[model samples]
Structure formats: C-alpha cells, structure tokens
Target chain A: MTMVAQTGANTGVQGNKTPDPAKRAASWRAVRRAAITIGLALATYELIARTGSFPRALLPTLPMIVRTLFAMLLDGSMLMHSLYTLYRVLFGFFLAMVVGIPLGILMARFRRVEQFFLPLVSALMPIPSFALVPLFMLWFGIGNLTTIIIVFYAATFPMIFNTWSGVRSVNPLWLRAAGAMGADEHKLFWKVIIPGASPFIITGMRQSFLRAWIAVVGAEMIAASNWGLGWVIFDAKEFLNADIMLASLAVIGFIGFAFERLVFGSLERNTVMRWGMMRSAKS
Target chain B: MPLIEVKDVSLAYDTPAGRVQGVLGATFNMEESEFLCLVGPSGCGKSTLLNIIAGFLTPTGGEILIGGKKVSGHGMDRGVVFQDFAQLFPWRTALGNVAFGLEMKGIGKEEREEIALQQLKLVKLEKFANSYPHHLSGGMQQRVAIARALAYNPAVLLMDEPFAALDAMTRDDMQRLLADVWKTTGKTIIYVTHNVAEAVYLADRVIVMTPHPGTVKAEIPITLPRPRDPLSVEFLDHQKQLLNYLGQGTSKAA
Candidate 1:
C-alpha cells in the first residue's frame, strides 16, 4: 500500500518533466488500458453468473451488484456505514499521530527517553494488530472501542519509527550552524529540527494512515460493529448477499484510493516537495 | 585589549589508544576587524580551535574571551560557516535562510526580511532569493550561508574551510567575494584552511598550526594590498613562506 502511494506520487512528479505530446499519449494509453481491463473483468463475472454453476445468490451479476449499491446509497445505509468506518479510522489515526510524533521526537533528542522507549517499542511493534483484536474485544467489548483501538495499534508503530528516524537523521551540520547563529534549544527544535525532519514525518503519516485504513476494516469484521462497511461485508456473508459484499468492497477500495491520492498527495506537494526535500525521489 | 582572545585552550579525550589531544595550549588574540586565517595540514586542530571559539565545543582547559567576556556557549555575537553544503536548511529559500539568524534574535518578519535582502545583495545573491538551498550550486549556497551569518551583525565570523568543496574556479570567485564582504562589513573573521595559497591570499595574519596534539607554530603577517593577485611575486613569496611553516609542522609530526 505504501509502495502504491509512492509510485503514484513518483509518476505525478515525472509527468511534469516529460514532453507534452508524449505525456498526453502516455496518459491516454493508461486510460484505455484501464477501461479494457475493467470491462473484461466485468464481462467474465457476468458470464460466470449466467452459467448458474454456483448459486445465483453467491455469484451475483454486475447489474445486481450495481443495483444493490444504488439502493443502499439512496436509502443512506451505505453512507452511514462509510461514515462510521471513516470516523473510526480517522479517529484512530489522529490518536496515533498525536502520541507517536512527540514520543518519537523525544526519543530521538534525549538519550534517556530513547533508552526507555526503544526496548518497549521494539517488543510491541512486531505484534500484529489483528493478534490483539480478540484481546481488545474481550476488554472493551465488540463495538467502536475495540475497532478504534486496533486501528490505533496498527498505525502507531510506523508513526513512531519513522518520526524517530527522521529526527535522528537531520544533518548535524545544520544543528551546529543554527546553534552558532544564536538559536536556543526551543528555537532550534522548531525552526531547524522539525523542518529538516519533515520529509520522513510526512512519509510516516502516509504509512500509518494506510495501516489504520487496513486495521479499521479488519477490526470491524471481527468485532461485529454493525454500522461499518467491514461489518456490512461480514454480515452479508451469513445471508449469502454477495452483491452487498462486492458493493461494500468497492466503496472501501475507492475511499482508500481517494485518501491516498488526494489527501497525502497534496500534502507532499505543499510541504516536502515545495521545500526541495524530496528532489531525490523525482528520478 | 584584543577584540577576541584564546587563552591556553586545550581539548583532550580518551580513545581506545589512549588520550588524544585535539588542541594543546593554543593561544591567540585578534584585533577588531582583523582578517585572520589558521593554516595547517590535516588534523592540525585548526577546525577544533575554531569550534571552540564558536562555542560548539568546550575546551577541557583554558578559556575563550570575546569583548572582554568569557565565552561559555554559542551566542549571537559570533557567526560560523561550515564547509558542508548541507549546512544550509534545505527547507528554506535563500531569503529565508539568510533571515534565520535575525529570526532567532526575535526580529520582526518585515524588518528581518529587509535586512536579509540587503545582506544577500552584499553577496550578489539577490536574484536567487526564492531558490531553495538544494537548487543552488555549491558556491551559491556558500554565499547564502555568508549572507545568513552577516544578517544578524555578529561581532566575529568563524569560517571552517567554507570553500573547500567548490571547484578551483568557483573557489577563486568565492575568495574574491569573501574579501569584498570582509572589507564592507569590517567584521573580524577567523578562517580555517589547509590551503597555503588561500590563507596567504586572504589573511592579514596567517597563524600556522602543527598537527599531533596541535599547537600554534608560527604567525606570519601578510601586508599585501587589497585585490592581491595570487601569481604576484609578493603573493607567491607569502605562500611559499606559509607552506614552509606547514611543511615544518608535518615533518615534526613524523
């Protein structure tokens, strides 16, 4: 997921450098290839559905899936489910950032802080978020709490690790230069350290958000939160409503793609790219 | 009283081999607005001595004084330029970087930018005010650094081989620019370099240092006029004299 977002960003940067006609033709080729691939996949699915080799309920046609998606949208259940999922993921992501960024900076700057947190973070980071879902479900009950906690757990490690590395890797020469220019500790951190470390911090945010997106859905499925898109998919499995399942999956994929492309993409453009911290990534 | 004084300053640290002295009893004094250069071979502790004066490192013995006050740590009165091109903040445009020292002094945005622009003009980098550090060439970036160091009006400027990374042509241009800045600002500068010709070309007085527990070896004064040519007879004589001091230092180390 991180690699996908990075490559997407890389191409966007490269698009500026390519000649106009060549760039236009390349994009048009990409659009045509995408259309053909989607069209072929839908046709194959529809053909298999008509064969009736599997039950009609288990393998719905494209029209049936589209109709179910539209009905759910018109009645607002799909919107509510999406909103619920977004809330959980966003809230958990926010919590991870608030805690992880400061902690990481502290760990990097102070020896004692690094000593205290390094061991604990290392021990906890390798434990997958899903492994803790059952334990959280027992502790917090099968609802928003368990799901949000899982997302937070999934997101926090990357945030902490990336921020830590970013802060640590800031060139020492800048620090000395800033100090010699009469920057106190507070000024140094705000002006020199934070801006210098911004590239890694931004990358950490992207990675953690992707982690939270994955964790929220999986947690919703297991914790049986009735309102989320993940719960809808899991609920449809019992009733053999594969059309609803496919519709929910499509919505999930679309939202994740939108956030990755629009939200973080603009963020990179504004901060790191504008500042020239990401020149190496363009090639 | 001298404008700046280094009194028997020394730095020693224990390594796996044993105690290694960085600078041993290095003592010197500079008059106000004087252009001083420390010239030596590698590991001569010229840089270490400059770092001590910049307040980045505390000497284990002796002390430094600026304007009759004991130096403790980094202060706004002194500005330092490092050799590394990465010394400039990558996030800031040339203007913002030049304005950083003023910002640290709590100067207002409008005024600081105004002063920073004037300093950039002094370095002839007014046209690149909007360009980021990475976009600038090595020599241009060093010029921005010089602008930044001068913006806040530091009493003394410390330069650690600021043009060491540039090509010969760029280095020559930078040397001329630096000499112009020194004359215009009238700020005392202590420049560190291993290049004998560079030291002779720029300094009013060149302090030659010896390596292997470094100490001051010779202090040769160059009274050549401004815009001195490097190939001129007197300039070559000064270079040859400074090189002799450097050669003696290395031979003693061996």
Candidate 2:
C-alpha cells in the first residue's frame, strides 16, 4: 500500500525552505482593506444623513435602519424571519447534495448516461429558479414546496458539475496503484476516488449553498405564505418602509458572509489545507 | 525452480499508426533473491516488460509464471516502482502512503503504523512521517515510492528507472540505500534502467536489450564483489562491454 507514510517520507536533502512573506502580507492587507471599506461606508452614510433632497422615508439613514433592525429583533420578528430563511436554505442545500453528488459521479463515470441526461441538464441549468415560479405555483400550489424547489433548483447545478469534474479529474496513476494493491472496484471508489475528488465536491457544495440562499430569498419575495427575511423586505416595500427593507438586505448579506466564512471556510481549512491540496493565503 | 519466468512474451499497442510492437518474443527468468537489471535504449519495451511481469499489461503473446503459476492481474506479490514518480496520492501523509499496502492487507492501524515507521526508518525518512508528497523533493518522493513497494513485502520488486530523475549525488546515495535494503531484506528485484553504471553497480546479472521490436541482446553475468566500486577496472570493463553492445545494436537497427 503506497498509502502508508514510510515511503512517502522525506529521507533525502530538503529544499523550498523560504519564509512565506506573501502569506503574512495577505492577512495584513485583508485587515487594512476591511478597515478602509468600513470607514468609506460610514462616511457615505454620514454624507447621506447630511443631505436634505431625498425624502427621509424613501432613503433612511444607516442609523435609522439599524434602529429599526434592533426594534424588529426585540419584537422577535427578526429572529423568526432569520430562522425561516435559514431553514429553507439549509433544507434546500441538503436536498441538492443528496440528489446532485451521486448524479454527478454517474455522469462523470459513464459517458452514455451523461449523454442521455445532457439535454435535460443543459435546458434546466440556464433557467433561473425565479423564472420557474409561475410553473411551480401551477404544479405545487404555492408555499414551502415552491420556495424549497426554487432553492433546490438554484443549488443543484454547481454540485452536480463540480462533483462530476472532481471524479473525472482523479489521476489515472492513483487508480492503477490502487488496482495493483488489490483494491476492488467498490474499495477503489470509496478509498481512492471519493477522497481524491472531495475538495472539488466541497467547493461545489459551498457555491451551491450560496446560490440556494439567494434563490430562497427571491422565492420568498415572490411566493412566501408567511414570514421570512425576504417576506419582511417585500412587506416593508408596500408600506414604503426603507429602513426595514435595508435592514433585511443587510441581514441577507450578513447571513451569506457568515455561512461562507464559518461553515465552508472551516471545511476548506480542515480538509484541503490539512491535505496540502490548498494553502490558506491568510496564514 | 525459477522464482519468476517470462516465456516468449510479446506486447503490442493499438496506436493511430496501427499495431505498434513493444516487446518481441522476450523471455527471461529470475532465481529467488537474484538482482537482475534490464538495460536498453529508450522505447526498447523495457517498461512494457516490467509492466507485463507486474501484471499491469497483458502480453499480446506468451505467458509469465510467478512461482510456477501463470501471471494474471496485478497483485501485491509483485510491487512496481515506476519512473516519473508514478503519482503519489497527494492527500495522504508520508506514513499513510507507505502504510497503504498494510491497510490493503487488513493489518490493524497500530500494526500498520509500526511497520510503516520501521520501513521509514530503513529508508532514513522517519522524521518526515507526517509530511505530504508535494513537500518532498523528487529524490525523496522516489525514496518513499521505493519504501512503499518494500512495505508490501512482495515476492518480487520491479523498479523502472526509479532513480532516473535524481541528481548525481542523490542517485549515488539512493543506489547505496537500495543496495543496503536489498542485502538486508534479500527480496528478488528486477530493475530497469538506461544507466550503464547503475546496471553494473546494482545488478548481479545485466540483461542488455535492443529497441525496434525489443528483444534480449545479451545476458552478462556480473562477478563483482559486494559494495562494488564503480571506479574499479573490473566494473568499468563490464560497463564498457554493455555500452559497446548497446551501440552495436543501435547501429545495426539503423
């Protein structure tokens, strides 16, 4: 088993021992850029607050939006809406993973199967989830199903494409080596193929999750039966409540950012970074 | 009885240019624990021969026998260390790469780790047990590759230009390391290389091959003592003779 560490160890002279200045600079630059961006945003908000031409109701100040957001939080509406959006996004994301990964692997491994599904995938891939809202409403009669379906539609493509590409891109040598070691087809798929393809699959999953979140919000705005962040923004639009709408927008952005950083970021760090497939520029 | 036998083996590939003969009616045998070197020019079917013995490629004609049984598909009985590093699984640690064979053998994790560590120590790479393949140099990678093969405890070791990519100093060190490992382990090895010096230094018998429908040109017995010096007159003479044989074969082909 060439998989063992003994043969893979470095017994000979070492090379490439330079200190990584790029990594240090990258983190410093990130912090500096973040500070500058925040400062500029605050400055813009202050400038808008000082202006008198725009109606205060239509263009509420950042402070006003924050105050409204705080009020909503205190009333439990913000928490409820946030939880509703999270549920839809998570449910859709998991559902997409369940359907997409195996399909992708099948497409990658079997050319005939890919050929059979090519037209269907190509047709469905480009059609926006929002574009399907009318058809979905006609079919499923408008509710959680419609929203979940939209999210599922938005998330499925990236997962399928990425997983397929990952499986296809596995080195032939690894397969040969595994075969030589007496790995059966099943073991080869589990041990060599899946692990080798995981980084790409995970990357695809992350992208799908982000897209699914966006699609869920769009779906909610168009077809929500009750409360969600998207519904809050849509409801505020009717009352001309710019503060509530802006606060909902900010919440959406924050949720997306947090999911990317906290979930996918840690996943990449622990797996690909530890495997040495990817290096974190930050460190 | 011979430990391994290749009887009238021939190989061909379906190329765009039609059937390209790789090895033509090649035959050889190896006694148990014998170190045999297969030396030839580029595209002389040296690698094809090794692959056939390793059961990676099926011969178009003839058969290979391992311990009197006909060779079938690839098995752990013959471990091949390919040229060009032959792709180390990037996700695995150095120890994990070496422990792969043990894992396949259904050895428990603790026992596999113990054997892998011992093998790493044998190759003087115990310090880099946690390191990945990309972090290691070409020579180090090949050393790990060699160690990976050895860890399988295969009946025969097939090496195809295993140290061809190393610098002169590293190559010499590897040659010495291989010799030490071979003497200690007493495993049968069939090494393939174009390097005459390496063939003379490492092999008990050097099998000279010619390209263009490859066939065995000569089987010169190496009568040198253990830890043979490359600078010695006897070694140089053998080296010269093998080089002359190769040169003559090439010219005749032309």
Off by over 4 Å in 2: A1-26, A280-283, B248-254
Q: What TM-score does structure 1 among the candidates reach?
A: 0.93
- Best candidate according to lDDT: 1
lDDT of 1 by residue, A1-283 (tens): 4553663554363334346887767667866877899999989989999998998899998899999999999999999999999999999999999999999999999999999999999999999998999999889999988899999999998899989999999999999899888888999999988888998888888889988999999999999557999999999999989999999999999999788767877777777877677742433
Task: Candidate 1: list runs displaced more than 4 Å.
Answer: A1-51, A280-283, B248-254
TM-score of each: 0.93, 0.92
Please report, as a residue range, the 10-residue window in candidate 1 chain B with the lowest summed lDDT.
Answer: B245-254
Point to the candidate with the largest DockQ.
Answer: 1
Model 2, residue B106: distance off in Å is 1.7
